[model samples]
Target chain A: MPAQTIVPVEANLINALEDRGLRKTSARSAVTTRIETASGAFTAEQLCRDLPEVGRATVYRTIRHLVDAGALCKLPMLDGAPKYSVARNEHHHHTICSRCGAVEEFRHSTVERVMRSLEKEIDGDIVGHRMEIFITCSNCLAESNRGGSSGR
Target chain B: MPAQTIVPVEANLINALEDRGLRKTSARSAVTTRIETASGAFTAEQLCRDLPEVGRATVYRTIRHLVDAGALCKLPMLDGAPKYSVARNEHHHHTICSRCGAVEEFRHSTVERVMRSLEKEIDGDIVGHRMEIFITCSNCLAESNRGGSSGR
Candidate 1:
């Protein structure tokens, strides 16, 4: 990766928010930074706990702002909570662990093409799609073998 | 699409749930029917009103069972509710109208290929991606010209 290119969208994102009349407070910035540097899907509660200084209400507001601004994307989890991830222009879908919620990003051109062909066969014209691949992560697989109870 | 095909599944599904030890109430049957016949994503609340006698908690529990049993696929809405559709072995994405929440399912084979090629080209190794195409449905487009909250 180039040292300065994509140097994290935080600074530019903050200015963008300020222009929209949303304050660039620490609470918002912390939330933004956490999202910008994050690897996979996360919830607002997860962000709040990571950045303890951010208030509960502020965390909610920041997440709302991020999604509205296209800075983050929201996905439906089987567990029913709305999870957010940093938005990237490049397209892909996740392979998630059902037990622990660990996520892996995947890119397979063949699968993508096959999916598209399927869509064309189903609907005359294609508009869009959401591809989330679920897998039991290695750690979660281990835990399941241990007979753990919390699906939490 | 065949009536006979659906009739047996309806019978077996109820039996299966009972085999798994869930309550066999009308609410459960209605929820199962809706998901079995649904052409697109939906929420538990949509079924709540449809099956008036079904308690809200039961509606939720049934949806949970459907997902757990792989009878339905959960899709996320931008607003935070988990919407479910009939389960399938294949993968595709969705195109949603921002205002009216009308969703149409579609696919793009080249988009994934392009994302993968981009991932490699940029050395980003794309992990996952989500794409939602937003446009006015034909009715919504017509309604908007008359200035009704065509979607909102």
Candidate 2:
């Protein structure tokens, strides 16, 4: 797949921090850069490993800041470990490969409409949503077929 | 809210175990019973805390067994700790309160229809799907209103 153009959301993230009266620290800037340049979802541990100079506490704090600012979205893995991705301004959902752990983003107007209708039905102000569909990717399916019943 | 009618799916759980040629151990029976009687989602730690008689290892193993057998569905909590609930035969989704930690289950045929359509669009078999909406519960909203700007 071609590289997804990173829509430089770092400026927006920095402004959000400033709005909350937070100082623009170097650690926060580094974390935002990493999040922006990331190809896909990443974990805090991965961030720490990749940026050894950034202390674990700083990484976590920056992550919390970004998440609170709505600049990052958390995607929960099957094993309960959450992966963080850039929170695009536009709403979308994820389709994850159960076997290969690849995530693809998609949006549907119908789902959005249904969610709006559900807010009235449930009598609560819907703040956020998470939707993920798990499937075996085509490559994994092909390999399983080739291996017959022995393949999982 | 009125208590949700506990559908007795324990029998199906046991049958699933039997189908896998697993023995009907007392530990499994206890875990199944606890799950059947649960009012909502529970974590493995909670289960171990509630059922001290069941060893921690036994609790984890039984949870894995039930999950593999499709007798339980693991819901990912916002904090990354997963909570397991009895997996009913039919499909459903949950709406969770971000403030008070309340969970509400709901089903919509429109959502189901869209999922089926998505499978064709993606050109992949949809094995499973998860949908969760995060909102502030009515009581929390009321409390926030009563406390004015001081309320979180």
For model 2 chain B, the run of ten residues with the poorest summed lDDT: B1-10
What's the residue-level lDDT of B15 in candidate 2?
A: 68
Query: All models, DockQ values?
Result: 0.19, 0.59
Task: For residues A1-152, write the lDDT of model 2, one tens digit per residue.
Answer: 55576545456766677778899888877877776776777888999998888999999988888888877777878784688877775678887888767667778787888887787777578998889988887877887889987665
Q: Interface RMSD for each candidate model?
A: 7.0, 1.4
How much of the true A–B contact set does each candidate keep? 0.19, 0.78
Candidate 1 structure quality by residue, lDDT tens digits, A1-152:
87777645346556557768886687677877777676778987888888888888988887777777866667666455767776555566565666567665555666567655555444233345566655556666566568677535
Residue-level error in angstroms, candidate 1, position A19: 5.7
Worst 10 residues of 1 chain B by lDDT: B118-127
Clashing pairs in 2: none
Best by TM-score: 2
After TM-score superposition, the amount by which residue A40's alpha carbon in candidate 1 deviates from its true location, in angstroms, is 5.0
